[model samples]
Target chain A: MDLATCLKKMELVGVLAFATVDSDGAPQIRNISAIHYESDAIYFFTARGKNFCRELLEDGRVQILCYTKYKEMIRMSAKAYAVPEEEQAKWRDIIFEEQPYLANVYPGDTRSIGIIFCIDRAEVEYFNLGVNPIFRDTYTLGGGTITKKGYNITEKCIGCGKCRTKCPQRCIEEGKPYRILQNHCLHCGNCYENCPVKAIVRE
Target chain B: MDLATCLKKMELVGVLAFATVDSDGAPQIRNISAIHYESDAIYFFTARGKNFCRELLEDGRVQILCYTKYKEMIRMSAKAYAVPEEEQAKWRDIIFEEQPYLANVYPGDTRSIGIIFCIDRAEVEYFNLGVNPIFRDTYTLGGGTITKKGYNITEKCIGCGKCRTKCPQRCIEEGKPYRILQNHCLHCGNCYENCPVKAIVRE
Candidate 1:
């Protein structure tokens, strides 16, 4: 439920899947083992010569995922930034010390090509499928926002009450335009599809 | 390895991460448990009203990923299409039978809202991180093309030979425009970034 618990679960995962956007505008993903944990940030290193590095530099947005044996998945999305020169050595040393195997890939002098990046602000979604009806929740750290998701009603609503009859969650509130309780929303576009007047919009 | 071995490893993963492009063009990922594998296709079911279902209906492009306990990753990219309405009942029954837990969520008549999708032509990538230097390979099934990735020389090559020296895979061949062995290429992009004339094109 807390970041520490999430970090501990991720550590058990051993390897993490990191995703980036390639030059061709397609999502590229690869496994990485150079991740290090900090009190408030997730740190990872990549060689400047790698496409993964170039993608990060071109667009800082990234999503890293780890799934544990317990059938729980923690997915974190953040805007990544390089560790500044002033603090690179500090974080790099901490990371290198934790991930000793990295030395095999970038030995001695070649280590200079390594770049350290930190995701200071992240939107983390913890999902558990261990139960019958899967559970999921979102957490924001370091000022990241948990954007509102699901369908919304427009002012054009005829208040036909058709949407209210079909909503599985029944979290819709009647007003000039029906409002959906996003936190309880299943993101099931039932109202959107069944609305006769087409007053629903994906938010 | 063969697709059989790949699917077995995927089964051990228990859950798979499925990626779909949202209306905003950003990749959205979520855990799925209703997957059923076949000789030439992978099938999964989702509620017709879910955003995930809408995404697949709007754009058939999809990517499904599974990472094993041995630090191996099998990612498949494919075009998903709904099972023909005539065959939906057959496949849906098979899915519900295989995944009994699904009936708990949508018991009785609610099960009709579930939609089944099949990915027949998939480009699969097998990646291993249990060892140093890492390892990766590509596989295609059902007539899907294995795409060429990494860097390539352009008309501006200038034949400076700087890139050839920097190539780590040693898969580059000498020519008017140096060629990178598509299969052996690591996609590290070392040559792409090291080109003195910036003549490398990333595909």
Candidate 2:
């Protein structure tokens, strides 16, 4: 799936698990549904006094993840910042209107205590397990950059095919230097660990 | 629910979401089922080369969470450390015996690539949304300290009953200093924000 499809899937899932680092340096997570998705960004609401809000304000780094029923895992990593003062109300109203249940938590004027934060740029990872041998890809929203992962065979290859034999997905191909099929790789590092010649390098 | 009950519930759920902070301080999370629970501790397995394993090794702080079908949210915040090198194989074998599917991922001696980690101290929070007004409580396992949360009315309470009127749970009681029923509190800060006297303090 592409960037837009990933965003659309997250919208369809509605609620997602959000992870953030607290002031004490421990990881904290909770399920949040108060979100308004944009083609290139995501806006969510949290009370100003809540720890979730404080964490976001102090350190904007956050990760939003969802595991769909079809065994697709979508994760977005980005820094979230509160909307500009002038546009907070506009975005908050849009979210509250979309998520009616939120009214019960912050009725009427109480909603003013809530703040809206936006993720304008993020690295999104799409990993699907429903397909045999699995499949994974990375995409960037806005200007976020993708982090390279998985293993690659180097020129140090002896062509012993040891990496191919140990690969759970059997994704390694023989040549002067073995080739790893990136799309179907599990990134489990089985081949990397078993390579007799240390010819594999992590990307 | 008590600590044991919460642990048992997590065991029944099989797979749970684990959140951690990577080297870059970005939040990372994944669903893991390779777990074994004890009366006051938890043991789990992860491959040594995976990012998840690297994060745990570098920073032991972690949060494990599971949301049940009955709208119960159970979260455990703790620092996890790799089991003693001498005992690693013993725990890993026990986990593999309990979780047969793991054999498919690391068959035969390849399992040696995995490592076991233990969480012997933790503060567990149980929050249930199935009940009206909600319910929440905290428990410590293996002497982990609980971090105080929610708000409390101080002697500055004016007896105006304004906090009570605004409390969604309506759990505040009339007194010289209004008392907040901690167990039933949503910790949403509605009363704290609406209090005219500003008598409420976060616990």
Candidate 3:
């Protein structure tokens, strides 16, 4: 539904998937629950000795995904980096406190083997299949901005009020060359398919 | 759990993930639910125009993974290929009959927009974190073979029975050179780590 709702879904779906590319260029994925979330960032912990740790260290590019039982998927594609050395312990303490089961894997002080990584910027796709005509939307988090997407009306627009009447959201603005509001556009391509002049540019 | 149970888990999961490498070498994943499974193979359908479809078509290498609510993960890595034309209709009819919801996405004849793919040979990993000390095992299906994994005992035959006592699975066979049953060995490294003679050859 929204970024906040997606974040809540991630928490409920413990053992989210974290995927990386191995040295052989094959995709590798693992289930991880040692994760703590921020409003606009995600933090996770992994053992220093594991191959997962090596992959993250060598290439910080990673994608984290969580799919809920309600048939909703939230995926974040971001470049991850180690948490600032000065604050690793502070964050690690919070994660351990929240996910007490992690203590079973790394008992007591042995958790020192854990390293913290943060994903603070990325494009996010939230897809919900629980409803008909499955809806999907994109959001940018942290410092990331939503790239220009959806359809744009070019100068060829005759402004015959065709798109304005057909738009589901009815957010289209009337002008010599009508513009569709990027944030509110459903991107269903209804206007593009119906445009008489073929004026809409799909970005 | 066993490989049979793992397959059941994948079916119960419904929305499993299949990932492939992009041209940039980044791993891309999508939630897929149109999959049909046989004892040693898996089949699925996707629209021809999707990024997931293109990735699978271009690179046949893929990893299909499903995580259960009980903290179990099943992943199969293999080379996927387009289902032969002769069998596509048979498989498509079966999938459509079983998953009526698919008809909502592509009504009746519109289903023709889909294409079938199958993965018949794969190295499978089953991991369950619900149990103490955790449990994991590998299964090779179809043409796949269990690779030369686990440690081997060389000619250095002290025969102190240290490995025999240390093996978790007790899969080590006693002889002049204590040999490990590669098929049953967990590759846990307990024997290799404890052997004083260090005769274990790790591959």
- What TM-score does each of the candidates earn? 0.78, 0.92, 0.77
lDDT of 1 by residue, B89-194 (tens): 8888888998887776555655676789998898998876565445678888798898766667888888878767665545678888887766555565667778
Where does candidate 1 stray beyond 4 Å?
A: A132-134, A151-185, A189-203, B151-186, B189-203
RMSD of each: 5.0, 2.2, 5.5
Candidates sorted on TM-score, descending: 2, 1, 3
What C-alpha lDDT do the candidate models reach, one value each?
Answer: 0.76, 0.87, 0.77
lDDT of 3 by residue, A1-203 (tens): 77777787888887777888877888877778889988888899886545677679888778778887777788888888998889999999999999988777555565665789998898888876676546678878876666454688999999897877666556579998998876555455667767899998776
Question: Which residue pairs overlap in candidate 2's backbone?
Answer: none
Off by over 4 Å in 3: A145-203, B145-203
Q: What is the DockQ of each candidate?
A: 0.28, 0.52, 0.28
Worst 10 residues of 2 chain B by lDDT: B101-110
Q: Which ten residues in a row have the lowest lDDT in candidate 1 chain A?
A: A104-113
Candidate 3 lDDT score at position A35 = 92
For every model shown, the clashing-pair count is 0, 0, 0
| Best prediction by TM-score | 2
- Those runs of model 2 whose alpha carbons end farther than 4 Å from true positions after fitting are none
Candidate 2 lDDT over residue span A58-118, tens digit each: 9988988877778788999999999999999999999999988777766677687788999
Task: Using lDDT, give the best candidate's number.
Answer: 2
Docking class of 1: acceptable
